[model samples]
Target: MNKGYVYFLTNYRRTTIYIGVTNNIHSRVWKHKLGEGSLFTSKYKLTVLIYAEEYDNISDAIAREKQLKNWHKQWKWNLVKQNNPKLEDWYDTLRGW
Candidate 1:
């Protein structure tokens, strides 16, 4: 079975949020960082991976992505804060991959 991921990206300092799902988290994030992803993310400059959840099924990841996208901004903030209180830009972390 293939793995899928539901992830949230934020602008520097967590000013904006974007939720998405992808089978290749690394490549997808790299695209966002390069401003080659969605227009929304590129316009907002939300390239930091603040939170992510892995799923064994693509359907499950898509469902989670939809759920997160529908959440209120405050709710999303709390969710990201729970795991990434500092809201660090994760792009550098993936550089060694």
Candidate 2:
């Protein structure tokens, strides 16, 4: 079975947060960077990936994406801070396929 990823993307100013689920993180992120990923991402120009969670199954990733989406803004920030204290862009860290 294909693995899955639940990830968070934000703008340079950290003004907007976008949660997404994907089977291939690199391809999805690359699309987001190119402004063709989603309407919200394109409208907000969100390309910085701040957080990501990997799962063995796509369904689990989708469920976590839904959960994070329902969280409050600050709560989401705190969660991201826990793993990524600097809140830095994670795009550079993604492995090339």
Candidate 3:
């Protein structure tokens, strides 16, 4: 099965948030962490994966990413807190993938 993902990354202090969708979440996040991803991610140093959701379809994942991107900062904060109250860096958890 093809998998898609919607994920969020933040800086060290959780001061910045980036929402994106990718078919290969691990690879995509790795690239971002290594500063080999988009200019925005690299410039902002957003390398900590704080939140993620998996999906079976790319379109749905893309739509969710777009929706989250347009949400207000506070709304996004609540969403993240619901799943990850501490907003801990999830990079290690994804390493085995």
Candidate 4:
């Protein structure tokens, strides 16, 4: 099975959060940072990587992404706070991988 990743992204204002699933978190997040990921992300400026999870299978990652997308806005933020209380941008962590 291929490895996969699910991640959450937000902007400085934290007004909007974007969730995604990818086989390569580094490349996908890099595209998002460059504003080439999606129309919604670009419009909302959600470039900060705040939360992420890895799965052994792409299907699992996709299912998790679907679940997160269906969650309430506050619920998603709450999840982020659980792991990232400060809600800091974790983009820099992808380096040297």
Using Cα atoms with residue i matched to residue i, what is each candidate's TM-score against the true structure?
Answer: 0.89, 0.95, 0.92, 0.93
Full candidate order by lDDT, most accurate first: 2, 4, 3, 1
Better of 2 and 4 by TM-score: 2
Error of 4 at 74 (Å): 0.9
RMSD of each: 2.0, 1.4, 1.5, 1.3
Clashing pairs in 3: none
lDDT of 4: 0.91
Best by lDDT: 2
The candidate, 3 or 4, that scores higher on lDDT is 4
What are the per-model numbers of colliding residue pairs? 0, 0, 0, 0
lDDT by residue for model 1 (28-65), tens: 99999999989999999988898888899898998888
Best candidate according to TM-score: 2
lDDT by residue for model 2 (61-94), tens: 9999999989999999999999999889998888
Model 3 global lDDT (CA atoms, 0 to 1): 0.90
lDDT of 4 by residue, 33-79 (tens): 99999999999989999999889999999999999999999999999
Residue pairs clashing in model 4 are none
* Cand. 4 TM to true fold: 0.93
